[model samples]
Target: MRVTAVRTTRAPAWQWAGCAALVLLGAVIPVLRFLVFWPMDQWQVDVEVYRQAGVSILIGRPIYDAMTEAPQLLPFTYPPFAALLAIPLALLPFGLVGWLWTALQIAATTAIVWYAGYRLIHRGGSAQPLVLGLLAAPMFWLHPVGDGIRFGQVNAFIVLAALMDLRRPRPRVLSGVAPGVLVGLAMAIKLTPGVFVVHYVINRRWREAGTAIATAAIAWLAAFVAIPSASLAFWGGALQDPARLGPNMGTSNQSIRGVLMRVGPSGGAGVALWLVLIALVGWFGFRLARRAWLRGDTVTEVAAVGLLACLLSPVAWIHHFHWIVVAILAILGADPLRDRRRLVAALVITVWFVCRLPWWGISWIAHDWPPILVGRILQNADLAGALLALWLLAWASAREPRDAEADAVARAGERSAAPGKVERRAASEAG
Candidate 1:
């Protein structure tokens, strides 16, 4: 009895310590290094774009006009509402705005990972394990997520919005309209998260998809009204400039074109390869969605949609690939501690983390290499990282017929065998 009392006394203390550690580590990434010390003046390629959009929204100029101006500022390429959203930031000094924005983003993203980890650990039950596992995930440590915080990127918000939608079923305008608004704003700002619309549609969320579409259209239209001719010109220029301005963009955009150029191949091959990848991944996603729908499995369907969106996009940046965090978390939420599968998932996540190591710029012997060698190495690492993310996404989407059927059967059994139905009542009455 004395020994039991001692063990019980220690358990709460340990639990408290564990919870504190998890919160600290989860927060440390966004608070470290460049994110910690980087000046607001030294914003990245996209941050500058957002800054321009913010400023434009403040000055009563249309976002599209600012996007298409002589200086060609605000590379946002997003819809009008995003500029409107950033308008508040424009009111503050860049230093203050960027700092506050980063802090808010970190908090939001941390919340998202915390909740997602909980769902995965508890299968939507208690959230203790979820919080702990998120603390453990390498991506939750030091990486692009921090870069996002430092640069004031909206990825964390995007992730949070999607997670909120998937966390439960809500039949409200907010439920349908909010995701659409978030996604539409994301699409307007970056044009990538537009894939979420496709995701909604494939999951038979026609009403939600329509709502998202309308929200995006209205937002874009608002931008158009703010600057009619300039909006048209900007759209035209965006289309016209791409052919002339291929891959001279930056080191970060070492896309298919970059690979082809490095290896002495034609641009056609690069574009062709991206197309092939999109088609293949699209087909795979279709199959997974179909199976999930037939089996009425919402969890797998949402995951497949997110994963396919990342894989199918032509220019998926490291931050863009963070959507896979959702995929892994979703799988874990749907299927808790099945040891073998968890091990495999862990292995894939480990490889992904290793490949993303350079993104932090806290390099080891690799960065110490000669400039040319380092560039090549970084390029290879980036490509490898993208492929690894795609591979994990594909692997996560794979469905064994037997397993899917068994899950379906189990769910069926639950419904049929549930307490106090008419059938149960009738059987009871007869007995």
Candidate 2:
């Protein structure tokens, strides 16, 4: 798991200033307009839901029984351990927590780039910060990422945890905490991260997988110890009811099931179709993921699995698509200057996500447009993006080095540019 660390040069003052400007334009302003000040802003209501769940724990109210205010009435949909963790937010003022939470999401997004795109950005040497700022500016405003910050969501933290867990020469965390512990904690907070367990099993990383399962179990046991009734409520039934998450047939839900629900196919046939599609995609996605790992591309392995999680989850909100950020880094394997095809592909995906294409599709539908087919396709743009990412990930990593001749050529090229086995070992891998 050792990586060849690149020697870094001291950044000039102008480099730091340029990086700050990019972040300010790309992230800070968007958060202010969309989340903090816009008339229709959600204003971090998700954070409010979390805080109220904390209040439920503190005041001895049933965790699931409590809901946010009218119009939304969002219930505490996370697991019991999340309620236990949210107690800290309960202790703080709502206003303070909202700002702090937004800051954390931004910081988490930065850490994600550091892990997923480390080699790419590090190549800039003294201009590394400037290059990162350039990447981060657009990254922060990605529709999915902006929405995550807008509603004070936790997806960024989960993304970071999963990436760090699988990253080569895994990044430092608490001493003796074990690698998969973060993945397990993420699962306890929201169940979607269970996909990573599937990834572990596929790669036969049995120790990490087992550690993750045990960690989640421990978190659940702790919650059960503190609030047996609440823990029972959540594990026994709350996790099963997908409807509690919201309208599955709605435009926001972009999973295979969600798309089929919107298609309005017949009953038994539709169920069969949904199940069939799920199996096909999961089998294909994981197949490629395993290949990427065997070929030594941990970045693509995680990115592929993360995209599968987003596409397969029964209720993927717009905010949950934050995985796109990581996928971007994975697709941009090696230097863009040398990989023009990868560069164009990455840029296309970026611009596609930057615009609110799905909402525009809905608006077209509302206006009774003649191009209904185009509108429908546009509406599912994000889901389609996930599928495209899976295929591109395979093309970019799993299928490369088609023969020893090509592999050797690629290796020689990498060696000429940088002197390290790590640089040649991975297609979408950490430095």
Candidate 3:
């Protein structure tokens, strides 16, 4: 008897087109609402600051010296290179620039979701479009994505840059150097992404790490050459003042330091507590990342490093928690069937974040609850989520089967089953 092999039909072209159309709609509608309906005063104030810095650069005005309009005088907080990048926005009229900036942010968020799905879910088949659409739809509702678009923040761009670096194939010419270039460019725009350099160090990618440092240095040097006074003022004085960034104890600040500031202790005591938590998170997060690297698990590696950046920063705003996307993807990518508990926990945490529970809960309790209770609960929401994700990732990484061990087990099973197969074949022949 002869058996015929069956072929599976791929998803049709219209299905992919529908997915693309839906993703585009999901990304565009909210951005259009924000641009058209949101009050002028509330319009992406950060973009205004950036545009002003860029204009200052063009007109020979000091960048750090220029401030946003009255009532908020928010100066540019990003590196000089970021101001350089903002020049194009500065040249355009406010209304036009706002529209363009919102569009760009929407694109960036879509790109981030696409990259996450590609890294975590897509398995090189016809399902890519469906997977991307599914990921992007829910991601649009994520608090960080909404907040980033609202504030015209660069969080999405930063996340995208990091993802690109993490997922980029080793280059043929300068194998390890290209990844560093991406990381360095990201760091040049904002210092927070510099944390990824430490990831390179932990993984013993010395060439990549050194290249990142060098690339950053070269970019900074270029900025300094362009505006020596502003560069000196920023690096020498402004960068050292954490107060300049914003109120670290605010609900918007979602890092470990933010939590400690709210409920842990004050002055030296707070500093000490923050230090201890940082040490613990660093140890566990890096260890987990190293393990994932060893196991060739890119999702965990990206998620681990991203979490460390948010937790270790002195002021990771709600928008900065965009890295939570990586954490969510990492959890979903883990063996959900085998690790049902973790999957449930991850879903719960993702829902909490999507609902913006921490901020909403704090607002609800502001008038009725004790300060300590409210502070502890509200301030620690994202931090707690980060901690839980780190723990879960570490646990999953530990349980992941090593390639060699899995192969060995398969070989052993094959050997044990060989005798049965031989006996059955002999019985059939004799019969």
Note the Cα lDDT for every prediction shown.
Answer: 0.52, 0.79, 0.72
| Top candidate (TM-score) | 2
TM-score of 1: 0.70
Report the C-alpha lDDT of model 1 over 1-431, residue by residue, as the tens digit. Answer: 01110000112455546655665566675566545555534544355566677787556665554542333233555544566566666667665666677667656655555544442432322334334545444545434465575556777777666555543222132433454565565566555566767766766767767767787777778867866654575566653454322243333443444444454345676668767756766777766655554544444454566555555654444555455555555444434455467547645654554455444332433456555556465554554554554455445545432233223222222233333222211111110
Q: Which regions of candidate 1 fall more than 4 Å away from where they truly are? A: 1-21, 39-45, 60-74, 121-138, 166-182, 200-205, 227-230, 239-251, 254-264, 289-300, 331-336, 354-378, 386-431
Per-candidate TM-score against the hidden true structure: 0.70, 0.90, 0.84
Per-residue lDDT of 134-244 in model 2, one digit per residue for the tens?
Answer: 888889878889888888899999888888787653454533578688889888888888898988887788988998999999998999999999999987898889888
With candidate 3 superimposed using the best TM-score fit, by how many Å does residue 104's alpha carbon deviate from the native? Answer: 2.3
Candidate numbers, best TM-score first, in rank order: 2, 3, 1
Question: Which lDDT tens digits does candidate 3 get at residues 173-282?
Answer: 33444667878888999998888899888778898788788888899999999888889989988899888778888878889998788778899988988999899889
Higher-ranked by lDDT: 1 or 2: 2
Give the clashing pairs for model 1.
Answer: 78-188, 78-189, 79-188, 117-130, 118-130
TM-score of 2: 0.90
Ranked by TM-score, the better of candidates 1 and 3 is 3
The root-mean-square deviation over C-alpha atoms between each candidate and the true structure, in angstroms, is: 8.5, 4.6, 9.2
Best model per lDDT: 2
